[model samples]
Target chain A: MTEVLRVHEPGLFTTIQDTGRLHAIASGVPPGGAMDRFAHSAANLIVGNDRSAATLECTLTGPGLLIEAPCLVAVTGADFDLRVNGAPAPAWIAISLRAGDELAFAGRRSGARAYLAVAGGVLGDRWLGSMSTNVMAARGGMHGRPLATGDVIAAGQSAMAAVTGRGLARQLRPRYDEHTLHLVAGPHISRLGADARAALFSSAFVVSPDSNRMGYRLEGPGLETSGEELLSFGLVAGALQLPSSGQPILLMADHQTAGGYPVVATVVSASMAVAAQLAPGDEVRFAETSIETALQMRAVQREALESLTS
Target chain B: MPPQRSTVKVRIHPLGDTALLAELGTRLDTAVNTRSIALASALKKRRDVRQAVAGAASVTVQFDPDQVTHVALAAAIRRLASKRPPMEEPGRLHRIPVVYDGPDLQAVASALGLSQQKVVEIHSRPIYRAFLIGFVPGWAYLGPLPDELVLPRRPDPRRQVPAGSVAIAGHQTGIYPLNSPGGWHLIGRTSVRLFLPDSDPPSLFRAGDRVKFFPIAE
Candidate 1:
């Protein structure tokens, strides 16, 4: 039988996301997708779905969902208190839900986002070969917007039989903590003064309330530059751009394709997922690392994830 | 315009682990933009390249580090930059019809010391080139506006600029494809839909396309 889910309460901001929309940046489309990619992929794996399958990326709070058909589901990332029909449900593991079973969150304990993956992924119209929703563009995923209460989503055909009791090992789960985010010097670092560069690493920055999917507006020691206006240039997801205001804004999943501000540094790929878990009011510090070290860290993490399914 | 020049210098820099940015020049020059576009087109054919995003004076190439190392990808881009191809022909010309009756029409005319009718005529005269698309989806940056029409962005941005507002700032002119807050000086409004999510290609204008504006009676 086909499976479907009805949203009872679309908590704070919930949207369907996959790996992301690639190759659309040339047209100024930001790569809007699951902020915590590591958790998104792991959740799909636990549910016997492809790692890039469409999954619900819940922000802050999670939505209350009613299962219309029996299927397997898993929730990963933030330590949200999960409950199935008022009974405690474990996260990071595949759980079976019968028809009319309700799934909801009690409260968030750690991290700022979570991923909910079903065995048969959410079947949504693909834009630029991705089911990920770009809310800024009002395109892709469930009607090209965030899930709202009473919305029904159809599930694709399950590629594997529904399985339960499959759980990720405790060591394999990501740890949520307040620590320094590693960074690599970006191209425009030379534009910054020595004192400003030192201040970037010396002081802690608080994520401002203005932060959103596009970027995290940081409030901290102002970074001083040479007062030169930069020509608009291409930007990446983790770019740490410093505008004339002197405050830094770390680009995220929905960052613009290009920006005119000077980028001082970029968060290492290995830590981008960790950066995504940061919430407003969270304190963050930066430590510099070499490009070689960043690539090695990424490879190590990829290998560890590869071992999970093997 | 003078004959096209070759031998433009391009600098390639690593942008995180997944992308490399090729800086064509420091300013908004046609030669530099052309080089950036040419390099982007050449890089798109490579299997290792995922996306090549062209900006005002640079092109960023996104790739899978697992499939191709940063060193290898940078080397490929360097080779393409050294032997830049000629600029591709501009895409089909898009004629956008506009009603010269925006709220800021009189304000813009007074600031430029020109009458509203002259302002409309000069604004619609040239066939502008779409340099890049950013700020919002489907909002094309069309430009190199005639010197007389160039004006600074308004000191205070409007809380909300209606969709289809044709505005200008500095050396650029564009239409707001969606209802967005903007600081550009609005000279007119258009009926054209710059973006349609359900339509194929969605955005009406792509980079390197030609655009023309004509006046329409309200």
Candidate 2:
């Protein structure tokens, strides 16, 4: 075990996360993990770690760390202006660091969250076989909460030597400029009348400030429902639930197990990467796609990622 | 078990690319929920399915795309849906004690056109079944409340309901396992600890369990 680094300044909401808890949702716990799976995996791949390796998910701002070991590290996701020893450093590439080096992320260039991965992956407290922190349950990660100042984290054994100066291919990088998240029509999409359906595509909805990891409540057309709230049903990430108030809630990684709101549509899994970069006021639109097309997009993205990591 | 109704067919829908939701019924009924739980339990035993969570009237299976295709899984679910739901073994009954003083007790009783004491008696009389555990971790949806006690949720939800706050809404009753924002009408408070994160099985209540509440002098 390698003592990785000590936190000097914890940013807005930095937390250790892997792919999330898959086995625990049956007990009403959601699979909470890095909001952007593509970026999380890319950051891990740059550091010679597997896709599910634990990484620091920094939101808005990032942490200031005092490096305790000579190792390779990588940063991905939101463009946080990374600095090492008071000098500017590039992101999406493995950077070699010396013991006692000062690594900090101060200002955000773009995007809402970022992922920082170490050569051997950061080790943290695990619950239900995942290190992803569920703050609501106070389970997993650094005492089951966001990283705070003066916390020292350990690094697991490096599988292999990650070559320094390695950079992610430009083609594989996510384009955050486009705010449209493509979705597939859900079972209850018909419940959202044609007028509301047209409005969903035509109007750009503003992401409400009340949005968080749980879900994003969108400010858009008041979708009228034909019937009363149906019996509560299982929910998944990216499901767009339309409540009686007319606003749609785009369920995210930390959404509840089930809810009674009528789900009009579900955002395609590949589009979740773009959704992760959105902030409170970011304008978002949704377009409907076929399930077959959604699967094809995922396959294409999977191939692109494989070409990079392989 | 009631006779299987051939009139309504199970509706299976895609939840993005990762999950498939099988909706058996639109209304919240014990028979429908039992079918949901049975279907979820069956799907959980499969190697391809990662997690199978049961809701009040549906079962959602999050499966591995590499291991199984949605088309193939949907077909599998179709086969499983046709089969009769497994006979439910008797669930463990939890007898809980409650303090009858809550902020909404008076309002709930008044809205139901019943005395506060009468409302409490109707609520505690029946042995409620846990249809599902949902909304939040360890919060079980216990239900089949007497018609006399049924009421709509509060017009506005509380921002921070204390843990162990026993509340009701519609035909269901639940205890808040954690401090959370809820719209349920608070009828009483319970001291029972419903969630334990450090324990191997973190949740104290499981889906399909039986719950009965009793009043105690504050």
Candidate 3:
């Protein structure tokens, strides 16, 4: 029996995603993938799917689902009020849905990005290594846009056959407040005045309404640089770039390949997933860490994820 | 913290965990960037170093904490800077083809107070070098465009710049692979693929590769 979910009302920003294209960025392609990759990976594991499979990354509210055939699925990340056939469904826990069952998701309660995983991943064509939608360029993922109503998604057959033991649901937790993001200095760190540089770590920044997967527009303290023009240079995901106005912008997965603005510091990769969940009106702060600490934190996360399957 | 340098006049500071940023006392030329790269390369050789990238006047290094502390890394950088040698054959040279008839061509040329043909000739003349790969993958920032041809990027970027679109913006020129929004003045298009995912090298131009441009009809 094939497991499928018919979408009655697609959410604000729903797209299929996997790990995303890593090497593509060097060629000016943004790393268009899951916003909260940790949750995406965890959800995939719960459903017994490959961590790299194409799962649905739904934002705040999502479409109501009509489950066909019996299947095991899990919801993680944001705490949306989920329901199965008008009955309350559990968050972060894998649940079984019989044929003709309906699963529904409502608006956000905490985090911004959420993950829905089935035993087998949703079927889709491959673009690079993911089904992720890069909305800016209109490429990949559900025709490269938010899922709309009437979208019939096909779930893998026998996806729910392995349902056996039950495990506890993992909570959506963050180590630091979203308001301040810690960063390592960038190549252009010294060009700014000491006062301006200090403001980057000391001051609180607000995520502007203009924020998206491409980049986060931060509204707060301004960084005045010594030079008016900076030589265009390399940028990474965690880069905290200050544009002409001196307002800092944190570049995200879909950020452009090269930029001319002076980057004050780069956010560590270990904390990027948490940073991805920050929505407009969300506050953020900056903290500094050594490169060694960043790599160590990443290693720990990697080890924890690896132990899940082992 | 700003570092006090006795040999040079540039004030520099540590940029978090990876790089150093310095204000240029004078406008930098190819020679200055070359010197920075050499110093960065030396810093990268330390057992603690993971990466070392050079800007016009500053350098960023990624190092292992177990092998060395931040203070130790800073000292090593200071010591290396004082005894740096002249760089030799830092990177390869590359020539890219461009079709010079983008939507913003005329506006860009006029901003430089030059004719359209002059803009094409001047832009295609120089053999620029790749500074670094950042912002996105395969996006090369070829620097030191002739001063007269340099123009500011658009105040409002185009909704989408198609793949292989060659453009120039403020002392730098590059080709955009994979359609993306950009503000650079589009002078032409390129037949030579700058970025290919399946290709072995992926990106045709790497940091330190010298590049020249050839104009082709749209």
Candidate 4:
């Protein structure tokens, strides 16, 4: 019989995500996906699933899941107090789940989001070649939204044998408490006055409570621009846009495809996972780095992930 | 005489390690938009480009840094700009039927010093072109409005403009595919759905498509 997982209680915000929906920006679709991609891929690896396997991205709180068939599962990201059949369970490692086994979370210990990957991966309709859900657009994933109570999701047939006792190394796990994000100068960086630019690099920005998947609104120094009217242009995730209000907003996975706000800088790809783990009231500082150094950091991160696979 | 090709200078800037922004011009003009669209089409065919999104007056190319460096990618785009790619073929034309009975209709007409009927006629007469798709999914920025119909956006934007609201701001006009808070002056509303996620391609119109709005009686 095919294994199926049923949601008893869909916690705060649980959505299915993969790598992302690539090449859909032409239609104004944001590349929505798992915010902490490193953790998402690591969870899949622990369960012996492919790197791009569809997994559950649980935000803040997690769901109560009832397994209908035997399967292997792993929970990674946002160290949550996890339990199975009301007994304490370990995180960041694959464990065998039997029929009628109930998995639940007590509370989150750290981080803002967590990833749950099951062996053989989760099955969902692929839109634009991706299963990632863009909640704002109500497109892709299961019913184009977050999972609800009583929703039954099927598990794909496993190709590789389930490898038990697999877990990520301690050092490989990302430290969610690290709040300093490395950035590279953006296209419109020169438009700002030297004083405004200095304020950006010197001040610590507190993540606002209004932030969501679209962006992280930071409350810090108000950056002043040259008051030039900027033509609307394509925007990439991680671009730090400074609107007329002077507040900087870091674009995230569900950000608009195009924007008119002047972008002062972009968070480096290597620190995107760190940005994703930040929660409300968290303080963050920015450090500017050369594009060459940013690329090198990304290479190091990719090499680290590759080592896990090997 | 054959139409002269645009010679606008294209400026390339690194967005980050993975993307590059190619600015064709600073203003919103047909020549600048045409160049952006053409360059985007050219870049889309390159293996190094993961995605090429054209905007009002710029094109952003997202590429894999591992596959191609930013410097190499920028050089290729500069070469394409200099050579000038062929203009994009026009997309399917759509005639959208709208009811000219929005709350801001009178306000827009008075602001433009034109009668309400005259505003509707001018808005419906021209076959506008889709400049770019952004701000929202399937929301096409259609433009080159008849000079007499142009007006600035409302000083205070509406808290929420209902979906299917046909609105205008500056030299452009568009239909709201989904209900959203907007600053555009609403002149009408349409029943046609501009976006259907389940449908193949999803959007009813693509960039470079022609759109004509016709007024319907309530």
Write model 4 residue lDDT over B99-152, tens digit each, in one string: 999899998888888899998999999998888987777889988877887777
Which scores greater on lDDT, model 3 or model 4?
4
CAPRI quality band, candidate 3: acceptable
Task: Compute DockQ for each candidate against the true complex.
Answer: 0.62, 0.72, 0.27, 0.72
- Docking model 1 quality class: medium
On lDDT, the candidate that comes out on top is 2
CAPRI tier for the interface of model 2: medium
Q: Give the number of the best model, judged by TM-score.
A: 2
Q: List, residue by residue over B1-218, the lDDT tens digit for candidate 3.
A: 34444474344555444434443333556665665667767866777776565655556564555567667777767667666355367577776767788777888767877899998888888788876665555777787888997777789889889888888887878888667788888878887766655554467776677888887665
In Å, residue A156's CA in model 3 sits off its true spot by 5.4
iRMSD of all candidate structures? 1.5, 1.2, 4.8, 1.2
Per-residue lDDT tens digits for candidate 2, residues B1-218, read 57663443778898888888888887778888888888898999999998898888889888988789888998988778778877898788999999989899999999999999998999999999888887788889889888888888888999999999999999889999999999999989999998888775678888889998999997
List RMSD in Å for every model shown.
2.4, 1.9, 6.2, 2.0
Ten-residue region with minimum lDDT total, candidate 4 chain B: B1-10
lDDT of 4: 0.86
Clashing residue pairs in candidate 2, if any? none
**Which portions of model 1 miss their true places by more than 4 Å?**
B1-6
DockQ, candidate 2, comes to 0.72
Worst 10 residues of 4 chain A by lDDT: A300-309
Better of 3 and 4 by DockQ: 4
Candidate 1 lDDT (Cα, 0 to 1): 0.84
